[model samples]
Target chain A: MRLATFRGRDDESHVRRVGLVLGQGDHVRVHPFDAGFDLVELLAESAEWRDSQADVAAAGDGLALDEILLLPPVYPVAMRDFLTFEAHVDGMERGHGSPGVPDAWYDAPVFLFMAPHAVTGPYDDVAMPPDTERLDFELEVAAIVVRDVSDVTPQEARSAIGGYCVMNDWSARDVQGKEMSLKLGPSKGKDFATTIGPWVVTPDELEDCRDADGFLDLKMSVKVNGVEVGTDRSGNMGWSFEQLVSHASRASWVKAGEVLASGTCSTGSLAESWGRNGSLTPPPLQVGDVVEMTIERLGTIRNTVGPREESVAPVAPARRRSRLEASA
Target chain B: MRLATFRGRDDESHVRRVGLVLGQGDHVRVHPFDAGFDLVELLAESAEWRDSQADVAAAGDGLALDEILLLPPVYPVAMRDFLTFEAHVDGMERGHGSPGVPDAWYDAPVFLFMAPHAVTGPYDDVAMPPDTERLDFELEVAAIVVRDVSDVTPQEARSAIGGYCVMNDWSARDVQGKEMSLKLGPSKGKDFATTIGPWVVTPDELEDCRDADGFLDLKMSVKVNGVEVGTDRSGNMGWSFEQLVSHASRASWVKAGEVLASGTCSTGSLAESWGRNGSLTPPPLQVGDVVEMTIERLGTIRNTVGPREESVAPVAPARRRSRLEASA
Candidate 1:
């Protein structure tokens, strides 16, 4: 079963409804739910999310999905995106004179916090920040935390996942390099906007696709306009969701409704390709370009790149150097 | 005028109310306000927050300030803490082999986001995470963003501050040093909890104290069990709140109700003093210890260090190296 957030196109206010998405694209139906705004709360407060599956699935009382605007499934309490693929890590950092993935990456997953106010939905138009000359996209999968968890081993961490969704960890390469140098963040460089959705699907829904390594055997691909630019198998990650969740929970409490996102799949971002020696780069995403990614069972998430409003300007270098440049 | 968030003793729920605090210490009168949660909203939507100040000041309906449980003045939409004091930077990093004060601290202000969930009231218990062996406190002043800011000049940024609050940027030295080694965070090391309050004072209230440096000349002090350990003038910060906010607003929008925190004042924390040779290290905070910080104009924010619940345990090293240890 798929869960989604939607609001009638005519609604002037931001009141959105959580609902069950049933049927295929043209036949899609949405059954408005009373689960409040938090999906993790819905899943944790009662077993109905799992036990009343058939009741929510009965679509007679639902509205057509096309008549509503989709919002992010939930604006998370805390959101984290982990870097676990060795190739993506090596591909982005190797040319810069840094050693490939640190021994630590293999030991346990590492992730970073994301901006809370910048969440966008699958279909939203993401405006390219003026400072970012290299606007890029990262194809990823995200898991939503179902309950409070801490000090849980990989086995126990398994119960932490409520669902998975298509994610676009949109990035700005130039700004990212500058901020990462400051040794603190991929701050405003990454804080602009991150998109996730189509809808969130429970892990049980993909049980039939599990591979020997305990990851779903799913084909993931990214496209610029209509051409495929990157592809990978969802099962290829060096880290598993369970391990990532377990690692994150070891220190602080991983609260319910928090998001644990898989970092870019190998070759998932244009910056990696640009850093790949001798590779021909796609002209950086321009206004009006459509970017889309799809995973076998996870569904597709599509977005349009748009120009930031004229009033939005890059802070002048005269005022502040990326913390790294200043330190040097 | 001072604004605060509090809940009545009779309520079993966390039904906090925004209010005005009038008078001093024992004579303090609290007039519960209905102006909604976001102080920025209260300041931005109308001039009444400033213009009608006299009417609200009349003592007709109010409760004793001591009768209510005070919470963090506002739980902001986004929180940013800046590394503005060169001394604090030098003090925290010099021993780690990091060259003191990255030139960037002098050039432009840099800040990192804090977890929204971990914010607590001025007087709340700060549970020391078991993983943090050297828990420390940073005495800083925080500004609440009053309006949406993007690409604004430093002068405009000045108008963006809604009020000021005393901030305690609690840190875990072992965890922070480890994470910074990997070049990403200040995350889990700082994600635990940050204390702010007693109450927030609008800039209008501090007109008499504005210093030559543009910051209020507030004397800030920190104490453990009633013994003063550190003190500094908040005005000594090398970077002003205006510069920090302007620098932050340069690339992306700084939303209303977001927090812009000053990095610790010089010698504001135990760790900084520990780095100062011959200063006996204050034992790292343990459960039951009381830590308090008082700022001249902003009043005092006192908190007890509490033990994380027994069930709350740090993830085992077998799972993930504290990002710091591996990098070293």
Candidate 2:
């Protein structure tokens, strides 16, 4: 079953409501739940709750999909994106003149925390950072944690995932490269905005899509301004979603409403594509260009590049002090 | 005025209440506001709200400090820790065998997003990550955003800060060094736990502590297991809290209740101390060790390192697929 968060197009209060999507394509409709039916709260409940909610959804005569504005399905309490695609890692290393992937890559499923406040709706416009010239988009899939757990095994972690959705981890390449050179962060570059949604597809609904090894055999792709940029299969991930989730909870608690994303697939990002082709053939994204990302069974999320705002004032250098001078 | 979040020690409901800290040490008390008064909501209000609340707090006979349990002053909706101390950065580079600080360090106040879920109270016990043998602590000060602002100048951003608190950014150096070698994260290394608070001291209360250049002239220090390991003046930060907040707001929004922290000070961490002395002088933190961080005017926070838990099952390598084989 597909679940979404939305508000009526003309809503003055802008109250978000969880809904169950019905029908398909042009005939799509949404069965809005009661005011207290929060998506995050629902995700935290047992499977019995979902079964009961499906029954309630079947009894309603819903509103047409076009009558409402879709919001991001969940406001993640914490968000972490993992580097789980070996091909993407290898290509990125080669792009920077490295021999191959770092040995550290094979040690564990490494990840970076993302600013949850930067999340936006699937159809929202993404503003380019004023200081960046090379804006890009990453195509990937993200899982929503269903319950709180800690020090859990991969099998236990697998059962804790509530659903999946398409995600676009937007990037400002110039800013990311510079800050990363300091070996500390890619914060400002990736914190400007991240787009997620269309809707969340429950794991149980996709059992048929799982291969013999339990990896999802889903096709993922991204397009810019109607031109296809990259494509790859979801099954290509070096670390499964369960492994990533287990690694995250190794010594810390994984809370309900937290999000863990499968990092960009092979050729799922412009930078990786440029690395493989050895050229910036399509150029970087610009204002007014549309970015569309799709994953099999999870649906699609589309966003347009918005105009860049004026840059903030430059940070002044520290005053030279006797203490600093002495240390230098 | 000092603000805090607390729960009655014997209360089974575990309801958190915003309070005003009153009186001096040993005779201190907390005047709990009505149930409707929330710290986060109050921070987002106009100055008029704060003025009225102060009058209300002055009229109440409050509860003794020992009658309640203190939580982190605020559960920040988002958290960022910035590298603003040049001494710490230089020491870190030297420890890594680098010539000096990266040129990019001078461009902007760089930061990384931190897991808000990992936040613990000032006096809480922090569990060491099971995988780490080289645990460490960082001494710092953190500011809380008082209002929502976007693309604000440093001067404007300064007024948006409501109060300050002491912070301890706990780290697993062994885990951090390995992951940072891949240049994407310091996530799991630092995400297990971060302690902040005693209570938040309002900016108005610290007027006498400001230096001629407007930098806070507060003494900061850290001690482990009763031994003083490091000390520095808060004024030595290369970028002011205002500058860090301004940089954070560039092309993004800084929301009330969010936190921005000054990264480790000079010799604040065991690794940095080891670098300066050319040895592991005090040794890494171990279970049962007490870590105390103090910033003058902001108060002190003490935490005991707890025992580590068992590690989760290891993540397996990706299966060799025909698609990956072809690519290789």
Candidate 3:
């Protein structure tokens, strides 16, 4: 079943509602929750609500899908984006002048947490921060947690996922490369924007998409303006999403509504693009550039890039350091 | 004045209320935010709600401070923990085997986004993830953003802060070291728990604590299992909270209710203690161990460490790599 969060286009107030998208002849219909529903707020009660999905869908105010403005399926309480594709990791390692993939990559699945507030809809205009010389896009698949899970095995963790969606993890190359050198997580570099949405597809709806290995074999691609910039198979992830979920909850409780993303696909980002061929580095995004991403099973999410109203110097002007500090 | 979020001791329901903390000789009086007050919900409207503060304080269901359960003031939209103090940075760089504090540390502040979902009450039990051999706590001061701000100057950013609180940034040294070695982040290591509270003290109440240099001079200390482990003056921070805030919003939108933390104070964390004397590395916190933090004007936040019910291997067992993957 496909679930969606949306607001009536006619209502500028933007009151959000959870809806069941019923596919009809040519137009799609949305069945909103009886009184009200908040996707993020309802994640904790997912199992219960899921049990009565039929009843809830049977009764609700319905409208044409085009009559509503869609919002990201869920505003996750927290987000973990893992670098699961060995090819991508290898490319990144070599790009940084490192000899080879670290021994630990195979020993454990690694991930970084993203800002929950950076989530935007399928078509929101992403504000290009002034400091970034290269604004790039990442295409990946995301799984949203439905139940509170902790210290669970991969098998048990598999059940905690409620649904899937396409994710565009936006990146600011210049700022990211500089700060990451300090050996901390990417905060400002990737915090400006992350796009997800159009709709969420439940696991049950993708029964046919699952491979024998229990991974989704979805085709993922990214298009900038009208040109195709990157494409890859989502199923190429070396580590399964189940392993990612379990490792994520290893020591911490992954609360309802948290999102876990399969790291960007091999060749799914522009950084990998630059590493592949020095002469082929696509210049960063320009204002009004349209970026669209589509995952075979998880629908499409497209966004337009916009410029920040004002630009602050990404890094303040350098200042004199203490004699000892400079020498060190 | 000082604002607090609390729940009645008799109510198992964790519903939170915003209250004004009025100090009396022997006890504290809490003016409950009447039946209509929602501190967490109204955080986005911080500036507006702050306007009618006088009226809200005048009329409310009042209770003794001890009669209610104090919770973390607010679960922010996002959290930015900055590595600010030159002392702490230099110590950490040396401890990590790096030659010196990176040149960029002086150029601008660098920070990582923390899990907003990890927030717990001031007195909550912090479950020590079973995997950590070194359970540690970081003592620091935090300022909560009350208004949406973007690309603002330090002067303008000052108005965005709603209040201040004592923060305990719990860490698992083992996991953090491995992750940071990958040069990505300290996600799983630090995402497990972060305690904040006692209550929020608004800027208006902190006027006397301000120094001529525009930084707070509050004394901060941490005690483990009733033994003093770390102590430092928050005023010793080289980067002011306002500078942290302005740098935070340099390229992205810092939404209302976001939290900006002054990185761990010099000698205010166990990492520093471990470095100073390897033998003095107090045994990693054990189950039932108590950890407490006190900031002069903000108040104290104490938490007991609890054991995780189950333990998953912190790092999953290693698996074979492909020929191409192994050699990269």
Question: Interface RMSD of the predictions, in order shown?
Answer: 5.5, 1.9, 3.2
lDDT of 1 by residue, B240-327 (tens): 6776777777656688878889878878888887776534387778788899899998999899988775433333332222332355
Give the per-residue lDDT of model 3 (tens digit) for A1-328. Answer: 6778988889888788888777643567878875477665454455566548636774765788568888889887778888777777777777777776787667677778787777898878888876777888888899988888888888888778888899999998877888887788676788788888878877777878776767777888888887888887766776677778778777677778888998888778888767656533787888899998988867778899887667665545323235325655
List-wise, what DockQ does each model earn? 0.23, 0.58, 0.39
RMSD of each: 5.5, 2.6, 4.3
What are the per-residue Cα lDDT tens digits for candidate 1 across A1-328? 6788888878898788787878876887887776454566655545454557537546448778668888898788678887766677777776565777665555445567777667799889998776667889999889988888877877798777888898998888777766665566677677778898988887878888876657665788999999999997667676678877876765456778788888888888887788776353877888899999998888888999987765433333322223323555
Tell me the TM-score of each prediction against the true structure.
0.83, 0.94, 0.86
DockQ-based CAPRI category assigned to the predicted complex of candidate 3: acceptable
Candidate 1 lands at a TM-score of 0.83
lDDT of 3 by residue, B1-328 (tens): 6678888888886677778877743467888766666554444355556658736675765688669888888887788888877777767777767776787677677788787778899988988775578888888899888788878888888878878999999999887888776667887888888888888887877888887767787889888878887787776776678778777777667778788898898777878767655443666777898998999878888899887766775545433336325555
TM-score: the better of candidates 2 and 3? 2
C-alpha lDDT score of every prediction, in listed order: 0.75, 0.84, 0.77
Which has the higher TM-score value, candidate number 1 or candidate number 3?
3
- Provide the TM-score of chain A alone for each candidate, in the order shown: 0.90, 0.95, 0.89
* Model 3 spans > 4 angstroms off: A8-10, A17-35, A39-68, A225-227, A276-280, A312-328, B8-11, B14-19, B22-36, B40-68, B225-227, B276-283, B287-289, B312-328
Per-residue error for A258 in candidate 1, Å, reads 3.0
* Top of the candidates by TM-score: 2
